[model samples]
Target chain A: MAKQQVISPLPGTFYRKSAPDQPSYKEEGDQVAVGETIGLVEVMKSFHEIKSDFAGTVTKFLIDNEDAVMAGQALVEIDG
Target chain B: MAINVISPGLATSVQDLGRPGYYHLGIPISGGMDRYALRAANMLAGNDEAAAVLEAVFMGPELAFTQDATVAVTGADLPPKLDGEARESWTSFAVKAGQVLSFDYLKGGARAYIAVSGGIDVPLALGSRSTYTLGALGGLDGRNLLAGDVLPLGAGTAAAEGRSVPAKLRRLPGAQAELRAMPGLYWHRITEASGRRFFEDTWKVALEADRIGYRFRDGRPLEFVERTPPFGAGSDPSNIVDSCYPYGSIQVPGGTEPIVLHRDAVSGGGYFMVGTVISADMDFIGQLQPHTPTKFVSVDMAAALAARHDRQAMLNEIRAMLA
Candidate 1:
C-alpha cells in the first residue's frame, strides 16, 4: 500500500474531534473513504471540516491536535 | 437566476452600498465591510455598482448556481475554487448550473465578496437590500444566508464579464495599516498624553473584531478629561451625551479597548468618539484582520476630501475599464 497525505484546506488550528470529550473523527487504523471527514480546521473562530480525498486506512497524523496550521499543510497520513 | 446555498460559510450575508439616510432613525448603514472589493466584484460580474453581493466574513460559502451565470470572487485571498478546481480572485468566471463554488482559507484581507451576474434578488427594505441583522430590516429576511436558502436573482447590467481590476488598483490589507482618522468631536475629553499615545502606538486588533466594530488592544488605558456626567450620559470616564456615531468612529469603552465602529454598529451611543476614520481609509480599515497591527493618522477635512476624490477617480477608472 502507498502512503498518502491528507492536507488541510485552510490556515487554522487543527482539531482531531469536533470538541474535547468527543470521539475523534478518525483514528489510526480506521478506514476512510473519499470525501470522508478526518478532522477540522478552525480559523477566526470558524470551524471547517478537513476531509480525506483518498480511500485508505489512517496511518498517523503529521501534526498534533490543536496545532496551528497553514494552508495546504499536511494533517494526516493515510495508507491507500 | 437563482442560487442554492449548499454550505453557508461563516456569517454570509447579502449587502450593498447600504442605506445612508436612516441613521437618525437609529438604523445603521449595514453594508459590505470592504465596499471597495464589493464594487469591483459587481463590476466584474456585470452588475450595477451598488448591486447586492454576498459578503463572507472570516470564511467563504459553498454555493451552487441554479442556472448558468457569471460570477466574480473578490477581496481577501480566500482562494475560491469552482467544482474543486482553483479559480482566480478579482476576476469573473462562468458557472454552469449544478456547479459548486467553494473557498480555501483566507490568505490576506478580511472579507470576501461574491457577486453574481444577476444580483441577489432579496426584497429591499427601506429602499436598500443591505442586511441589518440587528434590526432584521433588509436582505434575505434581514439575516445571514443559511444553508438551503435559495436566493433569487435580478437581471444584471450590460457590464461585460471576465473583465479584471488591474493588480495595482486592487486594495488588499497588509499585516498592519496606517488608517487616516479625523480627531475631534469628543477627542477633547481624551487626555493629551493618551491622545498622543493613540497616534504613536501600534495597536493590535482584538479577537472580537467583527462587522459591528473592531476593538484594539493597545495595552494602555486611555485617560479622559475629568468632568461630571452630562444628562442622559452614563457615569463612565468616557461617557458623553448620546450622539450619532458616523461609520468608522473610534470609541473607547471603559477607557481601555478602543473600538472602531463599522457598518453594522449601533446608530448612536453615549460613548466618546475620539476620532472618525476618513471615508477613503474605511476601505483599508475594513480589511484589517484580527491580530493585525494598526495606527491612526489624523488628517484634515481637505485631505479627507482629497482622498475621497482619489478613491472615486480610481473607481471610475475600474468602471471605464469594465465598460
Candidate 2:
C-alpha cells in the first residue's frame, strides 16, 4: 500500500493531543479515518483541528508534539 | 437579510473602526485588528470607511449571498473564491445571488477583512457595530457568526467591480518587523542594563498572540531594579498598584515575557507596563503571524508623534487611490 501525508494548514504551534493532559489522538499502527482530527494547529491563540484527508493506518509522525509548524508542512505519514 | 453564513471560518466577527469613550466603564474598544485594511475594504466596496465588515482570522468564512453584492477582501493574502473560482485580494468583485464565497489557504498575514456594498446591518450597540466578545456588548448577538446564521445588510449603492487597492497602499507585514516603542510608565522599575537588553534582543511572537494582546518569547528575561513593594501592589517586582492600561501598553509580568495589549485588552491591570508601542505601529502588529522575527526600536515622544503623522498620511493616500 502507498503512504499518504497530512499537512498543516496554518503556521503556529502543533500539538498531538487536545490538551497537555490528554492522550495522543493517534498512536503508531492505529487505524485512521477521513475527517478524523489527528492534531491541532494553534495560531494566534485560536486552535484549529488538523483533520486527516486520507484514511489509513498511522505509519509515522513527521513532527513531534508542541512543535512549531509552518503552513503546508507535512505532519504525519499514513499507510493506505 | 442579504448574506447567510455557511461556515464561520475560525473567528468571524462584525467590526467597524471601534467604539471609544466607554473604556471608563470597563468596555473595551473592540474593532478590526487591522484598521487600515478594514478602511480600505470598505472604501473599495463603496461603503463608509468605518462601515461594519466581517473580520476573519486565520481562515476565511464560507458565505452565501442572498442578493447581488460588491465584495472586497483585504489584509491577509487569503484568496477569495466565488463558486469555486479564485478571485484577487484587495480588489472588489461581484457575487451573484446564491453563490457561495470561500477562500484558499492563507498565503501571508493573519486576519482578512471582507467588506460588502451596504455593510453588515447588525443593530448598533453604543453607536458602533464592533463585537466585544468578552463583554457581549455589540455585533451580531455579541459573538462571531456561526453556520446557518443569516445576516442583514444595510442599503447602499455598490461600487463597480475591479476596484483594486494599490500594492503600496496595502499594509501587510514583512518577513521581519520592527516596532517603535516609547519607554514610559514603569520604565524605572527595570534596571538600565535590562532596558538596553530589551531593545537589543530579537524576539519571536508566541502562540498567545490574539485580539486581547500578543506575547513575545525567546528574548532574554528582564532584570528588575530592587525595590520594596507598595501597598495593594503584589510582592513581585513587576507588580504595581492597579492602574489603567493604555492601549498599546507593553506589560511584562514576572520580568519575563512582554505582552503588548491590543484592541480587546482589559481596561486596567496590576502588571507594570515597561513601555508603549506607538499608535502608528499598532496596526502593523495585527498582521504579524506567529513565530515572526521582531525587534523593539526605542524612540522618544517626538519620533513617536512623527510616525503617527506618517501613518495618517499613508491612510490619506489609500483613501485617494480607492476614491
Candidate 3:
C-alpha cells in the first residue's frame, strides 16, 4: 500500500475543523476519500476548504491548528 | 506580414487571460490589464478569447504590416491611424501589407489592446503567454516592448468583413469610476473613520501608477485602528506575514495611500489589504489613467456572485450568436 500526503496550496493559517470548538474533519487513523474536505485554510480573510487528493487513512497532521503554512507545505500524511 | 516597431509605447506587453493554479509557488497571475477589452478584441478578430494580444499603454508603436490581415483596437480611446489615415476603434479593418500603423497620444483611458486575427505568436511560459514583468517571464522576453522588435501573428483564417463592436461592449460612461470591493483579510484593523473615507471620498490615480500597482491619492493618510503584527516570526517591526493576494487586492502600507495591485503585481505583499476590488470590475480599474478620479464601493459576496453570473450569461449569448 502507498502512503499519501495532503498539502496546503497557499500560505495561511490552517484550521483543523470548520470553526472554533468543532471536531476536526479527520483524525489520525481516520479514513478519507479523494476530494474529501480535510481542513480549511484562511488567507487574507478568505477561507479555502482543503480537500484530500488521495483516499487513505490519516497518518499524522504536519501542522497544528491555527499554524501558518507556506505554499506547497505538507499538511497531512495518509496511509492506504 | 511582419511589422517593425519604431517606438514601443510607454509599457507594451503581450497578455492573455492569465496563468491560474500556480499561486502556491508565489507566481502571480499576470495578464491583460483590461481583460474585457482584450476578450472583445479577440472575439471581433474571430480568435479565442484567451489569445494573446498587445497591451499598449499611454501610446502605441509605429509599425508596418508586412501582410494583409484584419485587426481591431479596443479599450482606451487612442487615436489610431493606418498609413496616416484616421481610423475608428472597436472595429475590425483590413491592414494591407506595407501599411504603416501608428497611434497618437491617448485622449482618454490608460491602456489599449490590439488584436490580430490569429493573435500574437509569443512563446508560452507557465501555461500562459501573459507577461509577468516582475518575474521577467512570458511576452517578448518578459519586458516592455522596445524599438525595432517585430511581433509574429499566429496562423488562423479571418472572419467575414464588417464586424463592429456591440453597443453593450462599450465601457460605461463617466470618468469617475466606482470600484466594488469585498472585505479583505485585514479589513477589521482599519478604523471606522478610515473605512468611511475609503468608500465616501474619491481618490485620484497618482503619477506613480504602473503595471505593478496603482497608487491613489487619498485625501488624507489612512490610519489603522489596531496594529496587528505582520505575518512572520521575526521581531522586526517591518516584517509582514506572507499571504496570497487575489487580483484587485488593495494594500495600504503604514495605513497611508491606497495601492491597487494590477496584473503585473506581486503574488504576496507585506502590507494590510483593506479590501479587494471585485473581479468583474478589474478591467475597468486597469483602464484608469493618471489623475483619474475613482471611488471604492463595498459590496457583499452575494452581489459579486450575481454580477459574475450576469457576465457569464452575456458571454454565453455572444457565443451563441457567433455559433
Candidate 4:
C-alpha cells in the first residue's frame, strides 16, 4: 500500500465542513474515492472544494480544521 | 476561433475597464479588480485597451483553443501553462489550435488577466463587456465562466510572441501595503481617538474580502460619538441615514470590522463611511492577500490629487512603451 497526500489548490482558510452547522466531508479512516471532496479552502469569501485524487482510506489530516492554508500545501494523507 | 472552457477556474469571469455611468441605477461597475493589469494584458495581446479579457482569481481556468492565437497573462504570478509547459507572465505567447492553456499554482498576488488576441467576443451589455454578476447585466450572460462553455473571440491583429513587459513596469505588492485614504464625509461621527487609531493601527485583510468589498480585521473597534439615531437609521452607533457609497469608501459595521467597498459594491448603504481609499491606492488593495498586513495612511485632498496624477503619468509611460 502506498500513501499519497491531497494538496490545497488555493490559499485561504480551510474548512472540514461545508458550513459551520454541517458535518465534516471526511474523517480519519473514512474511505474516499477519486474526486471526492475532503475539505474546502475559502479564498476571499468564496469556498472551493478540495477533492482527493487518489481513492483510499483517509490516513491523516495534515492541516487542522479552519486553519489557514497556502496554495499547494498538503492537506490530507490517504493510504491506498 | 473560440476558447472552450475545459475547467472554469475559481471565479473566472469576463471583464474590461468596467461599466460606469449606471451606478445611480443600482448597477455596480463590475470589472477586473486590478484595472492596470487588465489593460496591460489587452495591449500585449494586440486588442483594444478596454477589450474584455478573462479574469481568473487565485486559480487559472483550463481552456482549449479552437484556433491559433496570441495571448498574454498579467497581474499576479499565476504562471500560465501552454499544454503543460510553463510560459512567462506579463509576456505574450502563442497557443495553437487544440492546445490547452492552464495555470500553475499562484505564486503571488490575487487575480490574473488572460488576454487572447481579438479579445473575448461576448456581446456588450450596458456599453461594456464587463460582467456584473450581482445584477446579471453584462458579460457572457453576466456570470463566471463555466466548464464546456465556448467563448467567441473578436477580430484582432496578431501580436508578436515574446512581447514582454519590463519587470520595473509590472506592479507587485511589497511586504506591507500602505493604502492612502482621504478622511471626510462621516469622519466626524467617530471619536477623535478612534480616528487617530484608524490611521495608527495595522489591519489584516479578512476572509470576507470579495468583489463587493474588502473587509479588514485585527484592528481596534472604533468608538463612535454618542448621538441619537437618525430617522430610518438602525440603532447601532455605526448606522446612519442611508447614503450613497463611493467606491473605496470604508464602512465599519457595528464599529468593528472595516469593509472597503470596491468596484462591484452596492450603490447605497446605511453605514457611515469614515473615509475613502484614494483611487491611486485602490489597485493595491485588490492585490492584497487575506491576512496581509495593511496600514491606512491619512492624506489630504491635495496629496490624493498628486498621487492620482502620478498614477496617470505611470500609465502614460506604459502606453508609450507599448505603443
CAPRI-style grade of the A/B interface in model 3: incorrect
**Regions of model 1 farther than 4 Å from truth:** A1-80, B157-161
Better of 1 and 2 by lDDT: 2
DockQ for all candidate structures vs. native: 0.23, 0.62, 0.01, 0.68
Error of 1 at B305 (Å): 1.5
In model 4, which runs have C-alpha deviations exceeding 4 angstroms? Answer: A1-3, A19-24, A27-31, A57-59
Q: What lDDT, from 0 to 1, does candidate 3 have?
A: 0.78
Ranking by DockQ: 4, 2, 1, 3
Q: Please give the distance, in angstroms, between residue A42's alpha carbon in candidate 2 and its true position after superposition.
A: 2.5
Give the number of the best model, judged by DockQ: 4
Interface RMSD of 1: 3.6
Better of 2 and 3 by TM-score: 2
Inter-residue clash pairs, candidate 3: A44-B185, B1-B67, B231-B241
Q: Tens-digit lDDT track for model 4 on B52-74?
A: 99989878999999998999999
lDDT per residue (tens digit) for residues B1-323 in model 1? 68999998778999999988888888888889889899999989988889999998767999998788888988788888999999889988888899999998778877889999889988888988999988998999988999999999997653444678889898887767888999988999988998998888888776577788888886478878888888888788888888888888999988888888989888887888888989998877667766677888889999999999999998889989886
Q: For every candidate, how close is chain A to the native chain A in TM-score?
A: 0.94, 0.97, 0.96, 0.97
CAPRI-wise, candidate 2 is medium
Q: What lDDT does each candidate get?
A: 0.85, 0.91, 0.78, 0.90
TM-score computed on alpha carbons, candidate 1: 0.85
